[model samples]
Target: MKVNIPWVVGLTIAALGAAGLGGQTARVPGSDADPASCAAGSGRITIATGNSTGVYYVMGGALARLVNGHTDVRAGAAETGASVQNIRQLVAGDYDVAFSLADAADAAVRGTSPFGEPQKIRTLGRIYPNYTQIVVRADSGIRTVADFKGKTISTGSPLSGTEAIATKLIDAAGLDELDVNRQRLDLTKTVDGMKDGSIDGLVWSGGLPTSALTDLYTTLGSEDLRMIDPTPLLPEMKKKSAVYDTATIPKATYDLPADVPTIAVPNVLLVRDDMPANLACALTTLVYDNRQALGAAHPAGKDIRVDEADRTAPIRLHPGSERALAGLTSR
Candidate 1:
């Protein structure tokens, strides 16, 4: 039930530095001054992360610190709705790099629903898998996605990857948009709603041990809350997109009684296709080289492996990232 105070403090300082609100520079751990190895480009860049309490925000903060300390590029992380919004803003030139679910990125590249036309986006690489977590109030009498009818559910922030998945899950369960009372709220608000009994359930796609969910489980206790398994809709979900897979949320993550079965999606680091290759290459290098430091910020960071990094399919790997991977693998 204890919070990670150091990680919180680190994120705060990084946020302040990124916003230019701090007078003194805080030294980032594991930073280096080797410009040649740090890539050959220098500029200020911004990373689009997800809701404040999610893993994207934590990882993005770590990435910003890594970039600022080791590379010539000064970096900052902005909290957004995730995936759908990240890609939109990344292409709009609002962010230099972004975190997104593979499904949304694929939709962006193919110009699928939620996107009117093919987007000119590319990937740095795949980082980690996001587990789809659906939780309901134990007293709500909700047993499955089918029981969602007439129940108020938080489908995640508007235009977020969580919302996209939530929609797919609902449809796969043969429910219409109007069948359930859908509330489009961010993780923070969704947690509040669940606690207040104003919300019966929620659909969230995030890294394991999400701070917001952790707080919820800690405050509400198991007797008041329960996790639901949506793998029953997996075959239907895969028919729509191949990004989903079966995974488990170990009880240790939140001290539940047992592992929770769920669907999983890979998350990718994305950028515009026109980004300078040298800069992209540099950023990719920083991510892998500082994996340990990133993991220190969040356990999800350790899942970012070089071998699995270039697995971003459908969404083409950025040329710069390809070059960085090539160099990394050859060594």
Candidate 2:
């Protein structure tokens, strides 16, 4: 039941700095100084990612490595409660960058309920999508979200994006949170609960090939565990946020018996608006240019593409990111 973080996270990652991306002097918006020339002088930044078992954590580490290796920025990745908490802490200056679900990021920008006021956060870019995985015990007699009423379910850690989406999925199925026995636990505990029969099902939002979920299916066997189709509620979910889309959990993934229909939401890397432009530009450049290093770190990193970099609508692109991408485009 233990979900190991692929790599140890600490001060060491930040201390191992890399030379700036060697090239022309940078002309990013905030400064006339060449970004490459300032590599050694850039400040340290932390990337907030999700549970250890999830894609964000793995890729966040790869991204930190990219920045640490290609730019002057000293970066570290922190395991966090995902979207909601990542945004809150990022805005509070607890972290320099954060990985967030698009819906949660949209809510933060719109001054939604969880966000009391509109936040001044900006996106570096949209990376990949988090497929909503709902796995339940085959014998639990639950085939749909509606069947979750009065049943014990793990909604992921409190304040995590998984929790937010779990609640939404419940409502989308015309069920109320108050009617379900919700257990707010981390992936490890949730897996344990599932194995021990204390938990009926769980909701997880992560990139394909999530390690924890793989362990669950492997341990329980496909015949013992089944994935519920979330497609039935997609219409209702989309009504709440355009970020929701239908996605497939391929049969090859997790070795499921068949492809499972599910919902997915895009993920975005965010930073506060005031982040130094040069550093932001360098960070953005590192993420896109040396993405191979990131992909080597995690498969999800391969999905961080240039075409989707500017898809962060509603939330404006960070000036640094804008300047960085502009440099790429001009080239």
Candidate 3:
């Protein structure tokens, strides 16, 4: 998507280049500027979101619109593989803001496997939680992760948080991914593959009422589609990463016969460490102030509480974001 910078954002950029009223530089290039001193900070930014059918895509678009329409900064969102890929691209300077799973964000900051070294990233805030959905055909006989050994399964797009969690779940259950016919596919193709019997099951991590999952259950009917409980592996998963939490897929969500137990992970918005404090503050405040419009865009936005907005730990919060959050409380 394209977002044209408003005259205000362009003007702010120009203003930041000039001397201040006190004869001091308005802002030193490439240095973090005080939020109070740089109220007019503005520029164009791209937000890396997830699959087209996912909640991140919807909420990200909403956020981009808010930034462009309300703030001095102009922004747009792009569809990506989600989480891991978003972090990598953000660090590589392909994007300015990124939506990522909290676990992946932690791994990136800690210099884990996918990331060769610690990435210089900071969080704007936590957004929402993603429920891990493991859907299977009723007759697939996939009672547990181990049952997937000889069966075909979709593990989400490569480098996505879904794939990362799926791999962890399989290993937690003492099953090797190599033993399963793991197909790396997106939500749309995975749903189609399940319907056509091309695959037996698929694992997905997404917000409640995930559009693609809803379509799967509606098209296949309860008897044809079943959700396997992954709660059994929670202990082991938490051992590897503390980000795993217990979550439920309520019957009302997909009209299922019962609530399904699953693992959940929080999602976060990230930016490079060098992002100006003023821009981060403006972006963060915009999301909080116009949250209702965001909720209108995607119900998941309801989970974006100001109280929880500053709870991005393990990954440090940007100074600008902290200032924005502070203003929320003072008001």
- Across residues 150-231, which tens digit of lDDT does each residue of candidate 3 receive? 9999999999999999999999999887888999999899999999999999999999989998888889988888899999
The TM-scores of all predictions, comma-separated, are 0.89, 0.88, 0.89
Task: Put down candidate 1 lDDT per residue, 1-331, tens digits, no spaces.
Answer: 2223222212333465657746865433213333334353555667889999999999998888777777555677888889999999889877778999999998999999999999999999999899999999999999899899999999999999999999999999999999999999999999999999999999999999899999999999988998999999999999988888999999999888899899999999999987767777888887887889989999998888899888887999988789899888787
Kindly report which residue pairs in candidate 2 clash with one another.
26-34, 26-35, 39-72
What lDDT would each prediction earn against the true structure? 0.86, 0.82, 0.83
Model 2, runs deviating above 4 Å: 1-40, 329-331
- lDDT tens string, model 2, 1-331? 2222234364333243333423534222224345443232455667898887788888888777666665444567888878999999888877878999999999999999588999999998888788999999999999999999989999999999999999999998888789999999999899999999999999999988888888998899999998999998998988888888888999989888899999998899898987666667777777777767777887777777887788887788987788777776677
Q: For model 3, give the RMSD to the true fold.
A: 6.1
Identify the runs in model 3 with alpha carbons over 4 angstroms from their true place: 1-34, 37-40
Clashes of 3: 0
TM-score of 3: 0.89
Candidate 3 local lDDT, residue 196: 95
What value does the lDDT take at residue 295 in candidate 1? 90
Which predicted model would earn the best lDDT? 1
